[model samples]
Target: MILITGATGHIGSVVLEQLLRKLPAHQLAALVRDEIKAAHLQAQGITIRVGDYRDPASLERAMQGISKVLLVSGGGDEDGLQQHYNVVDAAKKAGVRCLAYTSRALQNPATLTNQLMVRHFQTEDYIRASGLSYLLFRNILYMDTLPQFVGPQVFEKGIQLPAGQGRVAFALRRDMGEAIANVLADDSCQNRIFTFTGAATYSFTDVAQALSELSGRPVEYTPIEEQEFMSRLRAQGLPAVAVERITGFLTDIKNDQESTVTAELADWLGRPPTPLREGIKEIFKV
Candidate 1:
């Protein structure tokens, strides 16, 4: 049986949907922290296992008779490492054959987001050391990231970012989800690391232009210094750590550090990754 953690999340939900199209419902399970939130999935024939990463026994129970497990990274929490470690240990004890992990792109150990990346790296390492067949998917920035950050700005005034002229290889979350589903469905994808990204690269200015054309408004791109941007975000009641993490990501874009799009995603999905313009149109609908 194939099990998916974080099944209620954005990419995980999409992954589940795509997987259901290719695999039998009885062969699938979802490890969810909240049974109430996952009631709809249960109704759809998914075996819902109520468990949290913090509880290893619960994970062990959930992994019973599970063959493959997709481990989606959790959000920043005080016990993130402990929770992830518990899941890994439970998976090992449960004798899961194939393990898949979702990680971030451009995860250099020196960056501010390094802590988050380290957790993923650690999980990958543990899975490898467990002698289990594994696939590590280092994913690019989600296309929804733009709408999440820039949509409000566009609605209020315009898109403002510190990403100057640098381009990013951003993929839609659905594309990432589909890629993961493809990998999980293929028994041949063992002990592999797939770096997934969009089919094309785009800059912040290009994003602004797209928003302007779609919304029929003057969506300007304002490039600001990293410190100033962080200060503004902090003033808006964002945590200092969150501001630093987000600003570091923007700085990476500004430095041309995230512009790597490969054919690997398409090869896995048997289709091209979503284009930036098309993704924007889906979000804006104009």
Candidate 2:
């Protein structure tokens, strides 16, 4: 049986849904913290196991009788890496043969300099040291979140950021979930690192053009200084961590770290991913 952690999350929820179409219900289980949110999944005949990465016993119990696990990386905290460690250790103790992890795409200097990326890299290192067969999914930025980073003023104020002429190969979250499901079901992905990304790369200016075409407005890409961007985001009452994570993405893009496009996602899904324009329509409902 395969257990999917973070089963109620943006990626895991869809991953579970897609996996059900291919694997039997008896062959799948979801590790979720909220039973109420997971009721629908249980109704679909999937096994629901209450667990949290911070709770090792819960993870151990969830891993019982599970042969493989998809360890979706945690978020929203500085101590998130510790939570991931708890899951990895519990999975090792549970004797899970194959463990697949969701990691960020590798940057060009192979450096984990970004605070957020550093935490993910630390988790990857710990997973490698756990001695379990593993598949490291180095996922690129999700296009679904492009609107969020573009802020609430993209139509009227255009796409403003500190990213200057940098590009990102943003894939849809649902498509990535499908690829992760395929990885969990296939043994061939074991002990491999898959760099999952969209087939095409786009700069912030290109994103502005796409928005202009979709919204029938004069959307522009405005580049600002890093401090000014942070100050503006902070003025909007966003938390420091949230500001850092959002701006970190633009910083990485500015440095040309997230521009790599790959065919692996298409290879896994047997189809082309959703185009940026289509994804924008879906997210903005325009």
Which one wins on lDDT?
2
Q: Lowest lDDT 10-mer window, candidate 1?
A: 107-116
Colliding pairs, model 2? none
Q: Say which candidate scores most in TM-score.
A: 2
- Candidate 1: Cα lDDT at 61: 94
- Cα lDDT of model 2 by residue, 1-286, tens digit: 9899889889999899899989999899999999899998899999999998889999999999988999999886767889999999999999988888898875663643356777777888899998988999999989988877887877888877999888888899999999889877775645898889988988888888888888788889988888899999999898987888778767888987887788999999999988788887888877
Candidates in order: C-alpha RMSD to true structure: 1.8, 1.5
Candidate 1 C-alpha lDDT tens digits along 75-190? 88877867777877898899888888897666354553334556767777787887878888989889887866675657567767787888888888999999889889887745
* Pairs of colliding residues, candidate 1: none
| Model 1 spans with C-alpha error above 4 angstroms | 107-115
TM-score (all chains, Cα) for each model: 0.94, 0.95
Query: Positional deviation of 10 in candidate 2, in angstroms?
Result: 0.7
